[model samples]
Structures are given as structure tokens and as C-alpha cells.
Target chain A: MTKNPIVNGKLVCVALNDSEQFNAMQAEFAEAPYKGAPTQPVLYFKPHNTWSTDGAVVEWAEGADSMVVGASLAVVFGKECCRVSQAEALDYVEGYTLVHDFSLVEQNYYRPDIKGKCLDTTAPIGAEVVSIADPQALTVITSVNGTVVNETPVSQLVRGVAELISTISYIMTLQPGDVIAVGFPGQRAPVAKGDNVSSVIDGVTKLNNVLGN
Target chain B: MKHARVLFNGSTLDVTVEDSFSETGQLKSKADGQLINEADVTWLSPIAEPGTIFALGLNYADHAAELAFAPPTEPLVFLKGANTLTGHKENSYRPDNIEFQHYECELVAVIGKEGKNISREDAMDYISGYTVCNDFAIRDYLENYYRPNLRVKSRDSLCPIGPWLIDKDDVGDISDLKLTTHVNGELTQEGTTADIIFDLPFLVEYLSKIMTLKPGDMIATGTPKGLKDMQPGDTVVCEIEKVGALVTNIVSEQEFYGDKY
Candidate 1:
């Protein structure tokens, strides 16, 4: 099956923003030889194998208590971009969409836990891509079993869409159709087997999926 | 002079060019041996559809010393997303408020055949050709997590590799070549393949033992020590002796939205 038609031959990049909440979550590492927040965004790639669509049943790995939801918004590139100025970066976006970045609760924050983050069917992105007037002001509401769990404002994002495009462009060219997940902020909610999870990003898209035992 | 993938007729074609890399070139199609117009297309990364880009960290003894890390007995391998790969003449960016963003000049080995449990003796046979790569790093993003975090090394378009791919047979003894980097007109980084701690064949053999090495996979051998920050409008050239000169320009800070929270 195709992962996402628009994402074929395109990259799916995840940004590990050194946000205030991320720093707070990492306070456990504040002992001697403390390594603080990274000066910039740490990035990782979720191979196409991790991609899933709405209504797909993602198999929960055996023995894991719960999977965490990576509630995020992705910016789709509408045109080829390189070294784009932040002022004009937003112009490169085709639209915004929601993603259910599902993964096992991560214990290691320094290096990407390949087993936790790289499992198949870990990422479920919304199909309908929609243009947004202001991505920075949007709200993402995540619910488990019809109960509201977490609501985050796009403003909590350390870097907005424009800055993300420009900053990422500095390193590589952003091609049309490439999707950059702005990042999942704070500690995410725990999802378990047989749970119906939904992440709603108003005006953009909503992603629904079921975790299978 | 050798093999390259150029944009032609709206599609990227694997072609062997007849002109020297320094001059405007022509395409000799590998599929049908038809010569097509090279002027209408753009240059894409030599390994256009690569699986995983395995890069080395501090693979050179002196470079390790420069960074204050002990030389690793084994390869310091890291995976860069496909977004990091850009073609020659493409730009590498240095963002605002970043203290140090530098370029690393290294030799790239493109795997031609797939193999697992590959031995050191058969490693060279799996390599199709060699190319030059500029593994640019934004040091400000350095976090202890994955020592050289993706933000520091794997940012979009940070790795500019290729002008042309010189067949492995064309590039003499890998260890004998000189690898140098020039920012604009000034020579800054100077090193030799001789300094590479885990040499080409060993790197391939080592990597294959862990995972299958597929065709079109790239193993970027570590860069030599000399590194310096680049500015906007500066042209960064990575020249591998007997290989090809991979040229890239450094542009000014691309603006980002919002006050960095």
C-alpha cells in the first residue's frame, strides 16, 4: 500500500525542538555534566514505513504498557525552497496538516530510540491538507476514547512554519510535497491497546486511528 | 568527464557526460545511448534515490583531536535523512544567531551492488564510484544526545555531494588523494585520505555487517581536520584529488518566523 500519495519520493522530517517544555521534561538530566537545551532543532527522519493513514489499526508492540501520541502539525512545501528568508518562508508552504506521531513512550531523549520511534505504522497523517491563515495561532486537541486529554497552542512551538522552512532550508533544499512536522510539545498523553485516538487541529485536519493489541 | 544524474526532458536521467566537470556538459544516456540537451535541466544529487545516507563522525585522527574526542577504534556512524542531500551548485545555509557553521570535505563511496556480511577484500567491488561531499555542520545545535544531532549535521540541504561520479577504477589508491576545501578563494581545510581512521573498504565492510548495503547507498568517509565558518555569498569548494571538485555557495541567513521562543 502507498504511504501517502503526496509524500512519495519526498521526505518526512521530524524536528526535536529544544522548547521550554522539552527542557523542563529533560530536567532529570540537570545533574553534574549537565547538557542543556540544544541551541537549535534536532532532526530525525521517520522512514516511509512508519507512515499510516486515518482509520488504520496500528499494532501495539508486545510488552509495552502504552504508546505516546506525538501531536503535531506539518507544513507541506508548495515549491522548491533553499535559503528562504523567514519573511518569505510562509510563501513556500502549500498547506498545513495534522499527524498522529505515535511511538512508544521514550525514555532516552539524547539519541532517538530507534525501537520506540522507528516501528512500522508509527506515524498517521491526515489526508486533507488545508491552507491556514496563521499556523502559529492554531490549536491541537488530542483525545483518547472520546475524552479530551491535551490541548496545545501552536504558539508553544519554539519555531513557527516560516522559521522552520528558512532554518531547514539553510541545511537542505525543501522540495514541493516534502512535509516537516513542526514538533510535538511537552510530554504527550499515554495511549494503550484498544484505544481510539484522535488528534484534531482546527481548520487543518483531524487524524483518527485505533491501537490494536 | 564521467557518470552523473542530470535533469533532462523533465526527468532525471542516469547519464555519462562527455564534457569536463568544469565546463557546460552534455548527456550520453545510459538507457538508449542518446545524447540529450544538458542546458535545459538541473543537477540532482548523484545518488538521486538513496536509501540511507551513512555518515562518519570524527573518523580522522587529527579531526578527533581538533574536536577533543579520542579517536574511535570503530566507525562513528550516523544516519542522515535524504533531505540533507543536495546537488553541487546548490546552497548550504547558516542560520541567524548561530556561532559556528562549518564545512567538511570528504570522499564519498557510492555502493553499486547490495551485499551483507561483506568482507574487506570484496568491499571495493561493491563500490561503483567516488564523489566529493561537503558535510556541513551547524555546531550550535550540537547536543550530547546523538552527539552530532540532526540539527547540527542533517538539516535540510546541509550535505552537498557531487559534481560527477568518477568510477572507482579512475580514482587511484584512495589513501593517496588530497582532500581540500576552499571558501571563496582562500584555502582553509586541507587533509588527505591517508588520515582517515576507518578507511573506505573497512567502513563498507563494517557497515554491511550490521545492515544490508544496497545499491546507491553512500558512505561518506570522514573529513580531515581544517574547518572554518563560512558566510553568505561565499563559495565553498570540496575538491578530491583525482575525483571531482564539488562546489557549493553559502547564502545569508534565511529568515524564520516569530521570536525564537
Candidate 2:
């Protein structure tokens, strides 16, 4: 059973080496943490096991005790980039979507290499993966069961989407449909069984789901 | 009954089971043509610029001895990237000028969450399960460079993974699983997970302190002895005791000539 994740019309993989995300992250580290270079981009890998179709229905895994939710914008890439200029980064983008990368916070975050990402039903994506947009004008809003919790404008990113792509390109090759999940705004408050969590981006669309037992 | 990840028509799948695991015959038949077996097709690598491909060095005492390194005090840890991985049953393509490329067969644990400051008492709960891994490498991918780069490790196809992920819990004691490597039917490397210097839980606690590990992440536990220099046309086979075996071949590196590096 291959986990082929698709959002809009693109396959979900990565355009690695378009190290723009890491570059922006370093720039962010300079001020945010009052630190020096980050040395490395917050690089990540999504094996075939991690993908969920946009808006795919996700159920709690067997023996699962609880649940959690997150609201964020998933920046989707359309073309491959490997050391492209920041200005050219947007050209590789296919579009954007309101992606909900759900996980079990109760699962230890300390073992991300083992537990957090591989839970049988780890990612619960949203439907209506919107294509092409003005990211500058977008605002992401997160709510737990409909009441707003955290909100931020896309422009506030420590590293804009373009800058991050350039940073990542320097390390590895970025393939088409590679997604740049911008960092969480404030905190991704956890959701429990019977709780509903959702999000909406001014231009990216909206996603909603209820934690099931 | 549940969704399991697989590969179909060149893409890995997160498939929902129309049946059950107890129904092995039913599972295989239901997934026969749909689920491509590791030995049946060319396996491409699953990671690209992976934030970090973590490895627990000297897991097997036999491997530690062959390399002339003393057994580690704790898990001997190191990091690799998207370049280190190749697909299961893939062509372990090598550049013409390169020598000393080798294969290490081992178990892999896939992370399902962002782990940090986790304790051993709670570690097992984090791992999804175990799977097969062949950690192939070019002994000297570094040309005197202090740091490793994708250019040396990141060949189009390097690490080959998967027959299917066997749930870690079902694997019983992870530290003692058996594995053997055969080059064209000549058994070379053999060992067990029991030799690992760093067990899974401690590794989780150790890594989370340095960096944030995310879901879908992979950890190559380490390999056993039987290390050998692979040549073109050589068939590299890795067999895990109860788990399935993965067999890949060495291919010619015709594409490297055009690269800028």
C-alpha cells in the first residue's frame, strides 16, 4: 500500500536543495533567537508513508488514546529547483492549500524519528487544495472547535517562502510538488477526542475536522 | 481495515485495507498487482535532503570488529542525508572512478511524531514499526572535504528501502533481529540487532536534544559485518531473519560525467 499524497494536481514529494527554507530560517535565527547562523536548514523528509490526500478522512489508530490538530498553510511547488534565485522560486510553485498535518501530541515529540510521524493515521489533510495565489496578502487563522486560537499574516514569516527555497536548494535537489510548511505561528494547541480543530487562510482556503474516538 | 503505505505504479501508497492482517493470503492477493514487491521492481530512495538521516553506528559487534572500531559506549551516532538512501531492489549505481562502495543490511525505525526530551519508559510508544534497510555507501564520498555533501551521497538512486514495514511491536525484541548479506549467493555480512550500543529509546532521547525530529522521518539503526567492495553487475542481497530479503544490483554511472561538481 503506497501512500501517494496529492494536493491539487501534483504529487507530494520534495524539491530538495532548493534550500531557500533553511536560508530564511537562518536569517530568522539571527533575530528570533538572537543567535548566529542556524548551520543547517530545518531539513525534513517525507517518505511514502507520510502523505495523506487533501481532505482525506482520518480515523484514530487502534489503541490510540487521544488526538491533536494543527492549522497551517502548505506551500506547494510545481517545478523542480536546485540552486535557483529567490526571484525565480515562485515560478516553481504550483499553488497553495490549507493543509492540516495532524499528529498525536501525546506521542512523544522526542522520538520524531520513530513515533511522531509514523503513527498509522498521522496526517489528516484537507480537501480543496487551491492553486496559485498572492501569498503576500494571505492571513492564516487557526481555531479549536471554531473559536480562534492563533492567527498571523503570511508576511510575518521569519523567512518568506522565496528565501527558504533558495536556502534549501544549496543542500539538496528540490523536486516538484515539494511542500514548504512554514513554521507554526504561535503554538499549535493540541486537540482531543470530541474536539474540532480547523483553519482558514485568506487566499489558501479552509480546512476543518473533528477528532474521532 | 487500515491504511498501510506501499508503492504502486512508481509511487508509494498509503492504502486503506479492504481486508485484515490475519488474512495474509488475502492481503497479498488483494495487493498482488497493486502492491509492488521490493524484489519484484526497482526501488527508488524515499528520502531527498532528509533533514537528517540518523544512524546508530557499531550496532553489531561483528560490524564494529570488521571496521576495527571498539564497541561504542553508547550508540555511535552520525548523520547522512537524502543522498544516502536508495530504493529497495534498486540498481546500486556506482561511478566508474569510484571504488570501495559497500552494503550494510539493517533494521530501520520510522518516526511518526516530533520528539523532544522523551524518556525511555515512553519511547516504544513513539515508533510506528520496523522495516528493512540497506545502508549503501561510497567509502570515500568525501574528497578530503571536512563535511559530507549531497554531491557524494546524493546519487539519483542510493539507499533502497522496504519490502513492507513490519510493525515494530510485532518484531518482539528489536535489538536482537538477525540479518545476513549475500553477494550473488555468497553470504558475507551477518549479525543481529542485539549488538547495538544505543538502543531505540535512548536514541530517541539523545537525538531530540540536538534537533527536532518530525514525522515520516527514518532512523537506520546500523549494519552488520560482510562489508565488501561492490562492482558493476554484482547482485547485493540483504536478508533479514523473519522479514523479507532485499536484492539490488550495481549499475554503471553514465550520468555522473555531465554534473558540474
Go through the candidates in order and give each one's C-alpha lDDT.
0.77, 0.58
What is the clash count of model 2? 74
What digit string (tens of lDDT, one per residue) describes model 2 on residues B1-261?
A: 222344556755444333343454222323443543323333334332233466665677778888797887755554444544555566666766866888878777777666656777777777776667777767765322112233444444466766555566556677667888899889888787777667788888766543446665677788877789888888988878655576787776653223522
lDDT of 1 by residue, A1-213 (tens): 236755544445554552657657566556423366555556666655567788888768656777888678878888887767999989988898887777878776665445566556777777877888889888888899999888878787777777888877766667887788887856678988899998888646898989988
DockQ of each: 0.20, 0.05
Report the lDDT tens digits of candidate 2 across residue range A67-165. Answer: 555555666767766666788877777777765555555321111233443343344455554765567567778888678877767676566677776
lDDT of 1 at A151: 81
> For residues B94-181, what per-residue lDDT tens digits would candidate 1 score against the true structure?
6778888899998999989978669999999999998988998888767776567666777766788898788899876898789889
List candidate 2 stretches off by more than 4 Å: A1-78, A81-172, A176-213, B1-52, B71-76, B143-152, B255-261
Error of 2 at B144 (Å): 6.3
True contacts kept of 2: 0.03
